[model samples]
Structures are given as C-alpha cells and as structure tokens.
Target: MTEKKLKVDLSVPFPTEREAQIACGTLSVDSEPKRGGVKKELVVKGNVLNIHFEALEARMMRVGMNSFFDHLNLVIETMEKFGPPEK
Candidate 1:
C-alpha cells in the first residue's frame, strides 16, 4: 500500500520584498536530503516568504520543520542586525 503524505504550508511576511527574496534565496540553497523523505519548496510572493513542506510520515515532517525553523530564525536575526543588502 502507498503511504499518505503529510503537508504543511507556512507564510512569513517581511518588511520589504527584497528581504523576502533574500530569505527565499538563502533558505533555498540547502535542499532537503535525498534519504530524508521530506520535500521543501520556498518562494517569495511580494513581501511574503512562502514555504511548502511534504513528508511521508509525521516524524519526518516534524524533524524537517524543526531544522528549517532553526535556519529561518538565524536568517531573520541576521537581517534584523545587518539590515538589507546593497543593490
């Protein structure tokens, strides 16, 4: 029997489109591991960062989300400390 997938959608709003794009680009660089059984997609829509996650099991989903959030928190903190990058 085929296993059902668990999915999650997350939307994070930034002060500017530039910041959203930066976060998307930065986070997208680290793709999910092949054996992790998790898939992640990141996109920027205006000032919002959209994240979609899918996993074969709840444990996989939770672990993937926790790792992503840790990276996300660091990204937000860095943006807050250094401000936007120069064009």
Candidate 2:
C-alpha cells in the first residue's frame, strides 16, 4: 500500500520587495531539515513571499501549518517593529 501525503501552499505580500526578500531569507534560514515526513519551501518574488509545505499525515500537516502561521505572525511583527520606516 502507498502512503498518503498532503500539501499546503501560501503566498504573503509585503509592502516592498526588500521586505519580502528579508522575510524569505530569514525564515528559510530558520527552517530545519526534516528527517521524517515534512518538507517546506519558501521563495521571494518581487513583493511577495511564496511558501509550500508537504506532510505525510493530516494531523502532521495541520500541526505544521498552525506552527508556521504562528511563526509567520512573529516574523511579521518583527518586521513591523524593526524593519525600515514604512512609506
């Protein structure tokens, strides 16, 4: 029998391309290699950040997504607080 897998795709937009790149690079650095069933990808395209996630089980996928969003919120907050003055 074959195992089932799941994926989640997300895109986040920032006010500037530099901000998007910063977030992409920072988050990418924080990511750890998976030894089991989860994978993540992040890319920056102009002022947008694209995220992809893959997991082996529904529960794992859900947990991964939730954790990602939580970390994302922190990243956004940090950018807002420490990023260059917004225009």
Best model per lDDT: 1
Report the lDDT tens digits of candidate 2 across residue range 1-87: 987679888999999988888788778876644754678899898999999999988877777778778888888899888966455
- List model 1 lDDT by residue over 7-75, tens digit each: 999999999999999999999998999899999999899999999999998999999999999999999
Instruction: Assess candidate 1 and give its lDDT.
Output: 0.95
lDDT of 2 at 77: 97
Per-model TM against the reference: 0.95, 0.84
Angstrom error at residue 42, model 1: 0.6
User: For model 1, which pairs clash?
Assistant: none
lDDT of 2: 0.82
What are the lDDT scores of the predictions, listed in order? 0.95, 0.82
Candidate 2 lDDT for residue 37: 64
